[model samples]
Target: MSREYKNVISQIFKYLAISLVFMVFGFFVGQRFIPQEYIYYANRIIAILGVLFVLLAIFSRKRIIPSRFSMNYVYLFTFIDGILMYPLFQYYLYDLGIGLFVSIVLGTAVLFGVLSMVSSRKSGGYYLGLGNILFAGLVGLLVLGLINIFFGGARFNLVISAISLLIFTGYILYDISLIKYSVENRFIKDKNDLSIHVLNLYLDFINILLNLLNIASYLDD
Candidate 1:
């Protein structure tokens, strides 16, 4: 691999490590002492940090060439997402069944992985061709699914989760491929741009993982 590729890989690893640390810390705190209500707020705080990290990544991109800080944002977002999902997953796992949750999450991850590979080779043709169409469909599905959820329905939720896993997984692959290409092409020449890409990819990965985890937990239940 090229130096840039190596750098990117290293950055990913670093971020993953940092995320694990935070996840562990958060888990312990929540399990040991934090009240349920406070835990919810804590998760929100982490989420807010995630948003701030994204903003910083964007602003930083405009000022300097890409650096390690760019990758740091990716790790930050991953940690935040992991933290938020812990409690949410705990709450929903009992109702969803583990097998179903796993199926959904894995399905989503696979979808994104395939789409990312396609998007990379086609130079966004996938985005223009099928990506937008899928995105619109997903939005419509989400709306309908929300309605179903509100009406005390399970079918819509299952359908939506299944479809979402597919759609979002494609998104994950596309987003990650874009990030890799940007780094390779030198479009991400500054810290901010790099950070933005990292953050985007990190979010994509976390979403995929969380969805899969939810599916798995649901199936088990």
Candidate 2:
């Protein structure tokens, strides 16, 4: 990769690592004060913010404009996503059955790794197409998840969540790698683009971790 790409990747990872640290901290802190239902709402709000950040990133890149809108939105979204997902996971921890949860988590991780490798091989319109696919998948999974919560079995919900988590994680890694490669190739002219990459990765990490937490909670139960 080129130096610019390296710089973007570096920033993305840096922000991701920082967000993880804060997530852990917030998880502990939230345990003390927040209720479970409210936490779920908070998670949804963060999800919305994440969606918005991604939109800004895409728009800024297309319009040849740059803004800190990406970074701030991602940072806030990741933090809140983590905070809210924690309680939900805790709530379901005992019911998920440990053996099954472990299997699911491992499977999801492997799937993410594979998808990342595949996405890395293509570019240009491929990235845009992939992004659209990802967005659609997320929406579809979200609907299924909500349905499972109200009308389906716990096992069904867990399964859907695990798949969703893996896809989102793949997106996070893919987006980070793209940004890095773009910067290195001089494809991204604006520095703000770097911020967009960072935000995308951060959100990806948040979603992945939250899904993992939920899986863990299910296993514990």
lDDT of each: 0.51, 0.57
Off by over 4 Å in 1: 1-6, 33-80, 91-130
Clashes of 1: 37
Model 1 C-alpha lDDT per residue in residues 73-127, reported as the tens digit of each score: 5555455545554565444444465766556656755665566555555543234
Cα deviation at 195, candidate 1, in Å, is 2.3
Which candidate leads the pack in lDDT? Answer: 2
Winner by TM-score: 2
Taking all chains together, the TM-score of candidate 1 against the true structure is: 0.58
- Tens-place lDDT per residue, model 2, 66-178, is 44455555556556655655655454343455566456546655654565556555552345446666766666665665565456554765676587676676575457456
For residue 72, give model 2's deviation from the true position in Å: 4.3
**Residue 59 displacement (Å), model 1:** 15
lDDT of 2 at 37: 64
